[model samples]
Every structure is written in C-alpha cells, then in structure tokens.
Target: MNSVNNTDAAKPAAGLSINKRSRSWWSAPLREVLDLAFPPRCLLCEVIDYSSNSHSGSYCSECAEQLCPLPINRCLCCGAEIGLYSMSENGCTHCRHRNLRFESVTCLGMYEGPIRKAILAAKWSFSAVPIRSLGRLLATERREELQLLKVDRVIPIPQHWRQRVFRHFNPAWIIAEEIASALQVPCDAHLLYRQRQTRAQKRVPVSQRFGNQAEAFSLQDMHVVDGERILLVDDVLTTGATCSEATKLLRQNGARECHVAVLGRVLDSSA
Candidate 1:
C-alpha cells in the first residue's frame, strides 16, 4: 500500500485558510470605501445616520429615539395605546366588544410621528429598504414577546393580484420575510392569497372595513396551516379589519393559534 502524504493533505487546508484571510483582509477596506462613497442614511428620515449605534442601519439617533417601542400600557388584544390604569384581563376598551380573530398583537410603535412617516414613505415609494429596516427593528425590539409565542411559521397578509401588479412589491411580504428570518421560521407568501380585489381599507369607513375584507382572502393550502402556530405580518394595523379577516380564515382552516406583528398600530381616537 502507498504511504499517504499527510503533509500534502495539510497544505490544502492551510492554503484554504490563507485564501479566507486574504478575502477578509480585502473586504474590510472595500467596505470602508463603499461606505465612504455612500454614507449610510436613516431608512425613515433619509438623514445621515452617523451614530454607530443606529438600529440596523435604519434610523438616525433622533429618529431612533422618536421611534421608541410602544409603551407597556397598550392593549394586549388590539395593540392600541391605553392608559396604564385602564387595562383589563379580557381586553382593552377598544377590542373588548370587537370580534378580533388573532390571539394577540405586537407593534413597533403607535402609528404617528416618525413611524407613520416611515410607513407612508415605504408604501408610496414601493421601496423595500425602509420597510425591511422597520421589520428588522420590530423583530429586534419585540424578540422576547415574539419568541414567547413560539410561532411555527410567518405569513404576510396577501395582496390582490391586480394591486400587487400595480405596486410591484408587497410591503407585508417584505416585512414578513425579515421577521421570519429573525425568528428562523419560514415565510410563506403563497399559502394564503387574496380571492378578490377589495376596496382599500383606508377608503372604507371603520364600520365598513371588516365587510370590505370579508370573502376577500382564501387559503391556497390548508394543510400547511393546520395545527400550526402562525405569526401574521403587516405594514400597519389600522382598523384591524384586514388582519382580523385574515386571522379568521386561518382559524377556520385549523390554524392552532394566530398572532400578529405589525410595524405600526394605528391608534383609534374613538377607542
């Protein structure tokens, strides 16, 4: 039998290590050059984010401070801001009588100020950057709450084919993907789909919003959702109409539990 050349075998491993170091050595300077050429900007405010501690390269220090996490005084069911003294076991006044299908909700912040502007910019521009940053921020800030839910899958509230074609991107899908990545869960955009094009929830009055989304969504595959704990993602939760309708379908189709994660939660003044 021929003697094996152990030294030759070790040379290849050492060469591989040298190559990796070489690549890493060059990558740092290249990154610095690129960053110098295109300084990072706040994803929301579009201002230079010089702060080294910026959240996910998304917000400037000011914007980050302004976009702080929602206070603990929010309603657990609907994620609406409420006075600390007003919380109850069943739910807050906003969702006490309302028939919300999702088990609970988490939001980065109330929809206003910087958060509102960021969401609006993301929607109008059809840009994924801001929304992606917002999603990552949401995941980072709400990691504990989200992890406690033990969700098996992440799903974005789907858009109608027509609207999707027009928009060129689905904000919900982008947000869902980021959150799913953070949670190490699968993000399935096609498991659920819009059955019909419904009027924009914003266009419809609050009382009519639920009706608008009724029958607007259907499941493409029920087996995937059956007995699975799901985390539904959306850009914003306004009247909770869209999410509610989506959750109802999941629950009806045997989803064991459904939770919601939204970048912003619109505070209902009437509530």
Candidate 2:
C-alpha cells in the first residue's frame, strides 16, 4: 500500500517533467505573444470572441447551429439535394444526363448564408486566420460521412502550378488537410496534379467549362493513386465539371475508386 502511494505521487512529477520537456522551441513563445496581441474571435457572429472562451474553432455556438450540413437525402451520384420529385435509385435527372467517373460525392454544407460567407472570406478575401475555423467546422459537420467511407487517402483537388503560385495558398488543400486530420487518413496533395491551366471556368459559358476542364488536369504519379480508394476534396462544387474531370483522370491512372467530398454543392436548377 505504501509502495503504491509512492508510485502514484511520483507519476505526476514525471508527467510534469515530460510536459516541460515537450515545450515547443519555436511555437511556445510565439503563440503566447499572438494570443496576447490578438485574441481569437469567432469568424461568424463576431459577438462571442473565442480568445477567452473555448469552443472547437472560430464559429460561435449560434452560427455553428445555423450551418445546414448537407442533407443525407441527396442524389447518390451527384450529391444534389433530393426532393419529392426525385427517383430513389439513380438520383436526379441531371446525374443521369451526364456520366461521371467518381462513384459518389459528399458535401459538408450548403453554400448559402454563413457557410458561403466563411468560404468566401477565407477563399477569396485572403483571410488566413479564418481557415482554421472553417476547417474545424467542416471536419465536425462531416464526421459521420467520413466515418462511413473509411477513406484511405484525402486528395485535394489539384490547382495549376501558376494559379497556386499566384494565390500563395490552395483553398482545397486547407480543407483536405483538416478532413484528413479528423479522419486519421493520409492527405496526399501530390497524388494528382493540374498539368495545365484552362481558361477561367467562371467567365466561360457552361458548355465551355466542361470542354476546358476536360483538358486541364493530369496525374502526377500513377503509383500514388493506382489501386487506392481516394476521397477527392474541394472547397465547393458548382457545375461539377472540375471534379468530374479530376475523377476521370484518377480512373484513367488506375485508381480503384474515387469519391468526392466538398464543402458545398451548388443547387441544381433543374432539381
């Protein structure tokens, strides 16, 4: 009994020693200063600052609740929200019209409201701080879907080299990294590559977006993707042109299966 008490007493000191030894040489002081200088704030609702409070990430509890996660009742192939008019097996008519290479797509949330503002704020406005919050929200929201897939690898939708250089950061990569961390999967940014830049899809006609993207991306290394079950990730899905082209490339390179996961999906007008 005395020996057990002594051992228990020593354990806390040992733990404290380990913690002291583990202090990061680079981040400890820097993070301390950062916290002191700029206290963390919620990206949405700006009401409850996160500096003093502890919630998972940037969004306040209110905004977090407001976020509408992608509904489970969606078209299996295209990830479109299914309505009363939709079919059960094949999903909506739009997916039927276009043959896609990936097995299916899972989106995290709706593109409107807070989710949209958060994505645009970080993606276009170049607010790096908000990325962590956005990523956390995405990871938390899609926990169930990610668990179901048991994804082997998380692949960020590749960006053309020039575009990556111009932007200085890739939005898709950030989101993919968060999801990968949450799911304990390998995040393979190099598995796929955008070999060349197509003209901007946003400025082009809908027909041209498909044509242009079909020629945009290519596989970087066949070995990385070949025979692997991949979860391709992107910030948003609009016409599905980009993901479709990427999926086609992965299939051609010998990937066993490709599944897409995005932060949001543009609602199909036809649906």
User: Against the true structure, whose lDDT is highest?
Assistant: 1
After the best TM-score superposition of candidate 1, give how far the Cα of residue 4 lies from its true spot, in angstroms: 43
Worst 10 residues of 1 by lDDT: 1-10
What tens-digit string does per-residue lDDT give for candidate 2 at 1-271?
0011222345664567666577667666877676668665676666646443433346667776776553657778877777756664664765676666777888765577777777778787565556655765777787887778876788888788878787857878877877877887878887678778888766777666678897677665776677878888888877788888988887787778888888777754411
The lDDT for every candidate, in the order shown, is: 0.80, 0.71
Evaluate candidate 1 by giving its C-alpha RMSD to the native, one decimal: 8.2
Pairing residues by index, what is the TM-score of model 2?
0.80
Compared with the true structure, what per-residue lDDT tens digits does model 1 show for residues 1-271?
A: 1112223434664578777787897887876786788777777667766554333347876776677654668888988888878855577877787788888898888888778887788778755667767777788778888999999999999989999778868888878877887787888888889999998877777888889999888998777788999999998887788888998989999999999999888865622
- Per-residue error (Å), model 1, residue 100: 0.8
Model 2 local distance difference test score: 0.71
Deviation from native of the Cα of residue 189 in model 2, angstroms: 0.9
TM-scores, all models, native as reference: 0.87, 0.80
Q: For candidate 2, what is the total of clashing residue pairs?
A: 0
